[model samples]
Target: MTIATLPAYPPKPRPGDRVAVVSPSAGLPEVFPRPYELGLERLRRDFGVEVVEYPTTRKMAAPEERARDLNAAFGDPSVKAVISSIGGDDQITVLPYLDRELIRAHPKPFFGMSDNTNLLAYLWSTGIVGYHGGAVMTEFGRPGAMHPLTEASLRAALFTHGEHELRPADTYRDVDRDWADPAAFAGEPPMEPGSGWTWRNADRVAEGVSWGGNVEILSWLLMADREIAPDPSVYDGCVLFLETSEDMPSALDVFGILRAMGERGLLQRFSALLWGRPKAWSLESPNSAQEKVRYANDQRAAVLRAVEAYVPSIPVVLDVDFGHTDPQLVIPYGGRIRVDGPAGRVTVTY
Candidate 1:
């Protein structure tokens, strides 16, 4: 069978656009009120966009109801885009209940990551371009204020058009301060010095339609066969972007998943890979400064080993800022991605 070409869904958001914010996953706002409120305020005041919330936007309801809210948002013609309030673990369950025809008929930009990967993949399958970053509560709803990098990236993704070069942020943060404590906004989280992109096996530049998401989430997609095609040719010349979740899967787990992709002939097809910064630690698995550094290094090595074994020529960029970490950058699924392996530059056509 011939593999289908990746669909290109044009960018939709603009300043003064009315975007619908829904909780297709866990309703974190009902639990964590501060960041949720801040996220809403930023959407209105900072971006100059109107924020519309659905009935189940903050309700911890069943997957069917969440899917209903998604359909309602997309069905409304006035809504320019849809943004997730936050991500949850079981968004996979909501897949079966989604109205694919409705979503396809009204393709609008959807922004999210983590568990929202489920929705992103669903939208992609329906020929919609979904962004893979900037959840309402996390990035826009940042406690002290939005990171400069995050704000800049979101602006381009929302209002601007054409080729947007993605530069690595000079510094990054993952830890969250207390949203309830107003004093927590007194200072920004400490950021360590970061280097430019590290390219592996950089021999030539390659450009392709981009795909892939949180590695752990993609594994779930693989298991369910939700959106990912079984044939490797579907991913041929595609730029793959992947990052680990807060679970911080061990190096072995990361290797095993890639090994599975290799076995499926998926690894060898990608033109290039953008590996997101592995969230070294989270609140549950808080590690020392030294340990976090080690963890990130180990994860990188594991990915390199898998690529070397399966797709040695594909250039791999380490520590891209898109995944379970703070100051996340949005990636357009089924969109144009340029990887200049020699110059060590990456640009996305939104």
Candidate 2:
């Protein structure tokens, strides 16, 4: 088995161009009209882009319906890019119904994360590069204002085409506010001071094609074998990055997933693993400030335990801003990235 073919970056949209806003996953927009509308308004006012929503963009719909919206969005020449409304648990359900050939024939930039990872990996298999962050509802429609890091990273991904260096965010927010409350939009949510990334295992540079996504989502895909190739070699020499969602998998669960990947000869294929800054807190399972730090520490320890057992020499960077954290960075789904451990820096070619 060999590394799968690298995907071509689809056409980028220009200012004032049209972009598709589809909900291939859960349509949270219907329930959270404030955030959804704010996100759309930002696209128009801040980005100077017009959004065209499909029928499934705002409410619950069948998998077939979502797939059709995806196909319609990608196939339309007028739609320069496609962005998700939000991620949901059941996006994997739409995979079987996707028109792969149609998507391949008309490549367009697709932006999403979390369960949207399902679609990103699917696009990767089809040799079409999709973005791994910047869902409309979260980043664009962020209360008060967008995080500087997120806004910068997203702008670069959307408008530029070249090597872009990624830096550690000076601060981050892992807590999610109540989106249902109108007051949540009145001011910026509280944020705590953050330390930058922690590095281990090596002091040399590692560069390769990129792979991996939400660890939980990947687990679901592994069981279904939806977009993953039969050959484990497709991930060879890739710079793998994985993150956790707010549901908050236990440390044991994290190690178990990695161990499973290792058993499949997939874990050791990566040159390095970028462990995204885990969402240590969620509304459903809110922890005290001290507990939040403790949770993050335990998660890191679990990751180290898995790596030491599976790929001991692999350079691993912790607390990268690319997951369910405030000020997320948009990593290219199947793009190239360089991790210079010696300099403690990571750069991605957009």
Predicted structure with the largest TM-score when compared to the true one: 2
Task: At residue 328, give the lDDT of candidate 2.
Answer: 92
Local accuracy by lDDT, each model: 0.85, 0.91
Residue-by-residue lDDT tens digits, candidate 2, 16-82: 9999999999989998999899989988998899899999999899999999999999999999999
At residue 290, give the lDDT of candidate 2.
Answer: 88
lDDT score for residue 287 of model 2: 94
Determine the C-alpha RMSD for candidate 1 after optimal superposition of all C-alphas: 1.7
Per-model C-alpha RMSD: 1.7, 1.3
